[model samples]
Target: MTGGERRPVASRLAIRFAIILALALLPAGVIAFIKTDALESEVEARNEAALMGATVQAAMAETGLIRRVRGMVASLSHLTPTVINDPAACSELMRGVAEEEPTASLVAFVPVSGVMTCSSAGRTYAFSGNPLFEKVVRLREPGFVVNPRGPVSGTSVLGISHPVLGAAGDFMGYVVVSLSHNALNELRLDTFDSTHGSTAAPVEFWTFDRDGTLLTSNLDLAAAAKRVPASRPLAEFVGTGSTVVQDTSRDGQKMSYAIVPIVPGDLYLMSAFRRELTDVGGGLSAYMPTLLMWLIGLVAAGLAAEFLVTRHVRTLNRAIVSFARGDRRLQAIDLDNAPVELQELASAYTAMTESITRSEAELEDSVHQKEVLLREVHHRVKNNLQLISSIMNIQLRSAESAEAKTLLRNLQERIMSLATVHRGLYQTSGLADVRARELIPDILRQITSISSGPEKPFVTETDIDDLRLVPDQAIPLSLLLAEALTNAMKHAGATRDRPGKLRVRLKRSGGSEAILQVSNSRPDVSMRARIPASSTGIGTQLIMAFVQQLGGRTDSGEDDAEYHMRVTFPVSPLVTAENRERNEASSDKLGNDPV
Candidate 1:
């Protein structure tokens, strides 16, 4: 490509191949990603389900304990009114019952007077301000309450209460059983450890009443509260039917909690499991294989394109470039180990180059023959013009009149100038064009030698640049220069005994024009007076004619000391092969005619 030309973005075959390969694999990559996402979702769902199952299993122990407590409370409610009302006898009976049930912290019976008449610890208690007492009295049914410290037991406990009735079914009293919070926690941990292995992740268990009051927890109150979902109340999950949810704990750890009701509107159990249960590492690891496959496929495709196509294309391109830069060796491209298609293309290229080489060889030989014939023609023309000049010279020597001899001499000089032009043409290497630096100086030397005598010898100075011109411009240009020089030399004279000075210059003017100038010292006053008369002479007329033929303009003027003549013309552009052929055809049609 040229320096200013831009290579297109899509032109690189390797990159195009890589893009195509990537597009081809796009569906597979998308499918892989989708499958990986689905798999991660499935794993998450299964993990949540397993956590919910484990939480329910752990709550089973609490459920059975509550059931047994309810059965005992119901059984003890049947105590006779005489035993329930008698403080000492009822205290002995409650102590015995508390001893029989290991889970109960305190068992008490309060009569209708709002004072605890029966106690497991053998102590009298007042129920005037107890919330459980009011609840049991108002509802007249069995219920449970959570207390951080029970009034009777002086410790955190779950208070289970059942209303007692008299023989007549009248409201008489109620029975209250308090379960120790420490024992309940211990039992829950033991059940969890047995259900899940001891090495499994530690789980935090919390039990709350329908009022959102925490009853008991495996962890301390503050720590366990931190694990609860901050966005919702525990009462909101009371009847949610074994739901598992994800939330960030207050301590900034991610936790998955399963909420299961141990007693449907009375108590709830929530288990907090570690975050890893539903974590799939953000599903990035699952896409590793797809990403790796895409990379490998792109790389493999690029390599294959480079080896199979691009390398051979580059090889062919280099060979073509080398050939175009004039490397004649035709065997530069190696076809061995190339693919079949590339081999065929190389063979076709080789054939084409071979044909072009043969055509060039034939054309060169034909051009050589034409150049030889044209040079011979110029040589013969130069010889004939020289013969004509010699004849004119001999005729001038025998002339009888001064005017006739002068005229003969002038004609002879003009004939000799033509001969010089022909000679320059045949002598140079090129047939179609001549160099100004070579031919112009030679013409100047010849004219100066002929015009100089022993008494009036002239000094010539020339400044010429090398410029090539076709024969059409070169012929007229040479004739114009000869005429101008002859006219300048005719009246050249010494000033103060110095030799007559002549200066000739040929150079490029603008980028497309050339200037030729000839200047000579002015003659004596007597000779200068005849200049106006001589301006209409045959020499000046011929100079004008030659300039016209060259499609140029001319100027002639005399300054204080010297006479100057100049011709300025557009320079012919360098001849391309088409122009050269056209020039040759026109030259052939002209048939070697004298200019």
Candidate 2:
């Protein structure tokens, strides 16, 4: 497998075990989550109850204060007209009523003309445009109204009015009691302190009139207003019974509000408590125990796999890797203490390695025998060719005519060239191909020895690159080189005036081709001119035949002061036994085909 595709055995086993563990514990996790949700609901319910209780307690305190105010107003309504028409006596009576109720800011009697005639502050006031007077006059009923600034008290107040009637039951005027907003807020705080104590969560309370006019709050009026939900106005909760609702406040804090009526349609106490219970973040904590257990189980599984299985598998892997790296010496895998399956696998691997080693040894021996036989055949052939050359040399020495002697010597040189090829084959380690670097120099030495003499010595230069050729091409190439060298040496004769020079080069031309060049210095141009221009001679014909056998082309010409011969050919690929067998099979099939 590629490196990216491979994973550690321990990690893979750990992941699988983790999946199994999760499935096994799925029900328990679900149960814990359900329990957590139920617990959250219980907390929210309890908080709601506490909030409502606190609101109702504060509302009761407010209701008691309003009732006291009404009682005081009722007592004043029975006042004798003799004292009521006297402004000083009426003011004295109202001041005594205010003293009796510490929270009352004003006790006033306004006549039917909507003007206050008697007051606790002993001030006359016009109430014609006052909403409290207008409502009391029109409805002629007991009612409540909130004024930011009362004309009599000169402070924020809640006006509680009770309509009065004459002896004839005709509308006379109204007795209105104004309670200070700050005093009412202090009364509510006293109730909250007694009921909740210091340990209770902070709560804000706002009292609203039936007309939605904010009268008093335990906190700052503006801040307490922000505690109320923007979607629900205070008037919406005025006539409703005690209720609890969950909503976000204007300041974006989640809150639970308890709306409890002090007087069903006149006043409401709205207590806003921050939703600490419902806001509990329990999602992760609910699953933490299960997740922690899963992690522990996964780690244990990974360790177990590493210790019990992967360690043994890694040992086996090391042995296999060593064998593949060509270490023939067999190394034993110690897996006896491993699991039964792993032991059996190791046994099978050992047996397979043993078989492979034996096969390799036998194959090596067979290859050695084949190489020896091939060398013997080439050696015998070379000996026979040398014997034939020896015979031709003796014939040349005893020839009767000059032409016959020249023909015999040329034939001897050709036979000796074949011997040189066989000698290179037998001496080389590889029997299938010849090394041009070693063989070409040997062949050139043999040709020079036979053709050159001490009196007519020619300087020869050779540049050859190491190349390999099969026997099919090597034999013809050797003969071609021999003929070309012999012809060049004959024409390039050394004299006292100028020495003859012969240059030969063989090298790779491009990617898959080779070039062979042989050039000689032309000291006497007249002598080369005397030679026949037509290439119909034995040497020329033999060179052409060798070039054709090698599947190449040749070029020959005189350039400047030298005669040059160049041969270019494609290098044939080395053929292995498999390729040779395939080629033979194809040839047989083609031969059997109908023309």
Candidate 3:
């Protein structure tokens, strides 16, 4: 397989793998989810408490500013009807007092007649009808309001005022002071770093009068007020005690706010903070150990399935497939390393494989021994036939009669044909088949050497195909071909003055049959026949019998001046190869050598 290719698994195996994963990870996932939910609740609680503390701190800072303003305004002992009767004297006295007050933007004296009499900030234009002065006049005490732009050069300030008394302690005018916004902003806390200041989400501080009037804030008061729906009053958001609330801003951004009253039944302070997930102690990372364990558990389950389940299953499948295809040489699967659940199965498979291998080894050994015996038997048979042929050759040399010599030579050729079949059996790896093309060449060469004179060197031509045949059919086929070649050479004798041609051909005639033909060009046709008797020799009769025994047919005839023989036979392995070789000791002009 290439890197881009992946083996396909059966649907059943895929389903099994999925089931294992769900079993391993489902519980862990549920537990992790539960723990995560609990952690979120705790984090929200911490945020609520932290926001409440911050709002209280900021509310106390507002209280300090208001208290300082009221204290300074109330301690103005020089502010009496006598001192204020002279407008020039009162203005000069208020200017010295304002100079001594670093926390206030201005100090002024206003008459009860709803007009500014004389005051600091050079000259008061109008402030008598201001809520701060009116509240102090009505209650006969000091009062404060976060009205930074009231009755003075427009600036952010907390307004504080105190009512003055006549000698009869009757209602008179009030002395008012403006508290500086910058002075309140300079207050520091240990919780917020001094150098870097508050790194928390910016808090917007809002202080409201008792009448629920929107006074002033550290933020753009207009924008903050716009975030509140017009249907809801700002006082509704600023109840009595410190309370943290969350809502959406006008722009749909989520917001958290803490409201606290600085003065019990009067002024109130509210701190608004933006809520963000990052502000929850950096989200999930706050509990690193728990999150890490959750991830590790998931990974471990996957690894267990990969190594102990999926990998081992694939290994077992590979071994089984190899064995089914007749290969039993694979090494045993390691049961020791297998999971406890699969160890028994692995061990059983290993035993079965070993048993199969042992049985196959024994069977192969027995077959090998039998093959050796059969080959040796063929070898001995070949040697014995050669010995018999050699003895017949010696007998023919001594025979005086032509007939006896002819008989001896015929017998010797037959022996040699049988010997050739056995020789082929021993020579090739397969004991059952002999190669006809290979055997035919050897037989023709020997017959030609026996019949040819030094003057009549007969030429042999062969066009035989290589074909395999069982020994039973091959032995008879060899004898038939030898007879054909011997007959052609014997009758078509060429002398010193004549040369001869022989042609042999073997080819597949059809899908189930093969044809063999041999023809020769003889130097003399005036002998007037096929042989001493034309096709009547013992060799021809034996040829006929061999062809019949192999369930085939033969045809022979003379065409022009050449003698021809042809055989057609089946290609069944039980009835195998065929070959024909002709030696013409003649130079007679035939139409063609029919090969």
Candidate 4:
């Protein structure tokens, strides 16, 4: 019975339970999915701000450089020719201005007709045809020009010219500040600080004029920096507020840019990066927070299935197994802290188990009560029969005729046999079935005493294997055995010459058949006679009827030195009608009994 206990089909049940949890996580996945486009839009907006800010800050630095150059040029106008006569003094003034600004390479005074006087390099120059000289003298104000070569460095330079005005407000020579190529490049990416090598997208910085001429670029873009056509997007977008656009670069790399008009009259600042430079989608890093949250939600769902959802399901599985194995006292699952759906399931299971336990208790109580009533009825029947037997004995003692006394004794013997069957039932543990080995011996012993006389001194021997039968079957079998024993004691002789003997054996050996054998130590077939005889024709008929009722075959006669009877029967149907008859009889007795 222990080995036959069934184990849970864990794999199949786990899959079933997991599907329910998976269903619960489906909505979370949908919500995360639904948020995707909005989240990406939000991220794109922020990235645009950052890119525009980078370009603005860098352009501001360049604006600062241009401002400083104008300041330097204006300062030189204050230096007197009295100071210029002391060449050391004019050179000192010029060197001091150059050292104060990173972009300034030279500071000098150039006449309106284009002659350099009191230069920072300490040399004079003639520039009669200089366009900037004529422009500054004509305008009498600050002006700027990009020059490929300058009087000092001979490299590409930007010159800031501030015209010196006379006391009558007449424009005179110009105060010039010169910046070279190295200094202009310093302004290209002054504010964009991220390491380019570490970035996923390749970035570029460019500055262009309103007329579409590319001025300077952080990239190696000289070859690609042709004049912007009127049809290009940049031409229309130059004076607009800071904005982002997706377009192709000169090299045809797909790019997204944030463009803003930098200071100094429609000079545009642009910060750009490749849109498809990496195998992974570009600019997705900007939406990392949203993506990370989605991933976290997914991971949380999996953990919840393992720790919270599936764990409770497995617990329920074990609880069911224990309860089915007769643990009636098992506790109900706790619902207070459980998930809502699981709590409802647990509540249903608890109610179902409690119902089963209540039914089992009711059934057990009903069976116990039936057994108690049955035992009581059997005991009462035995007592009633005994009273009748007692009355018969008294009548027999005073009977006048010898034949009447003999009839009374036989009647007493039969009544006693019936009484013994009740005694067997009442004494049984459940008051239900009777054991054949036990019942037969008790019946035979009583009959032996009834038939024995001091002169007869009947001898009996027995060997019976234990078997159980119910009251109805026991009654007939008991009567049969009593009759046989009575016959053995009366006729199968006893005196000192030959003592009477009866031996009975009942057994089953490794098969479904039961055998009962009774042998008397007397010659059953002899005309000359052996032992003594008394005729009782009714005993033979009674024995045959009882055997037929038991569904058994019987043979009785002489076998060598002993007279024997053997009954053979199947080991099934030992109870038969006995249980049904008992149930009906109990119902009647209980129904009629007063409280």
What is the C-alpha lDDT profile of model 2 across 1-595, one tens digit per residue?
Answer: 6334777753565456656766777787778767767876775566567677777675667667877886777777777344767888888888888889989888888889977768888877888877767777897887777777777678888888877778788778878888888887776643353223354455578877787877678776778778888788777777788888989999998887888777779777788777664333444665577667766766777677767787898889888878987888987889857999999999999999999999778555555666688789889999999999988888888999977987787888888899999999899867567889888888888888887777667778889988888778888999999999878876775554566788889999888899989888775755666654553389989999999999999999996778889999988887753356345545655676699
Compute the lDDT for candidate 2. 0.78
Candidate 2: 10-residue stretch with minimal lDDT? 190-199
* Backbone atom clashes (below 3 Å) for every candidate: 0, 0, 5, 0
Best by lDDT: 1
Q: Runs in model 2 with CA error above 4 Å?
A: 2-101, 104-118, 124-200, 204-217, 221-281, 289-308, 365-595
Clashing pairs in 4: none
Predicted candidate 3 versus true structure: per-residue lDDT over 1-595, tens digit per residue: 5324675653435445655666677687678767877877786777777777777675566567676666677777445466777888888888888788666677777778867757777764765566755666677665566664654757667767677878888767777787666666555232431112346445566677666765556555576675543344666754467676777666666677667777666677766666662256545655666556655665666576667777777777778777877887858675447787787777788899998888668545554665577789989999999999899999989999988987888788778877877777787665456677787787777677766777876778999887777777777888888788777777666666666677788888867788888888755665435346553368878889989866788888886678888999886654222211011111111223365
Residue pairs in candidate 1 whose N, alpha carbon or C atoms collide under 3 angstroms = none
Model 4 TM-score on a 0 to 1 scale: 0.46
What is candidate 1's lDDT per residue for 1-595, written digit by digit as tens?
7525899967789989999999999999999999988887887777667777777776667767877888788878887366864678888888888898888999988777787768897777788877766776887877777777788778888878787888899978778789997777777643343223354566688888777877777777767888887777787887677788888777777887888877788778898876764454555776788899999999999999988889999889889888888877878578557899999999899999999998677666666778788899999999999899888888988999988987887777777787888888898787667888888888888777776777767889999998888778878888888888887777786543667889999889989888899999988776667554544378878888988887789887888889898889888775653367655755654565566
All candidates in order of lDDT, best leading: 1, 2, 4, 3
- In candidate 4, stretches whose alpha carbon ends up further than 4 angstroms from where it belongs are 1-12, 15-314, 317-321, 335-345, 400-402, 509-512, 523-536, 572-595
Model 1 compared with the native: what TM-score?
0.60
On TM-score, the stronger of 1 and 3 is: 1
Cα RMSDs, all models: 8.6, 8.8, 15.0, 17.7
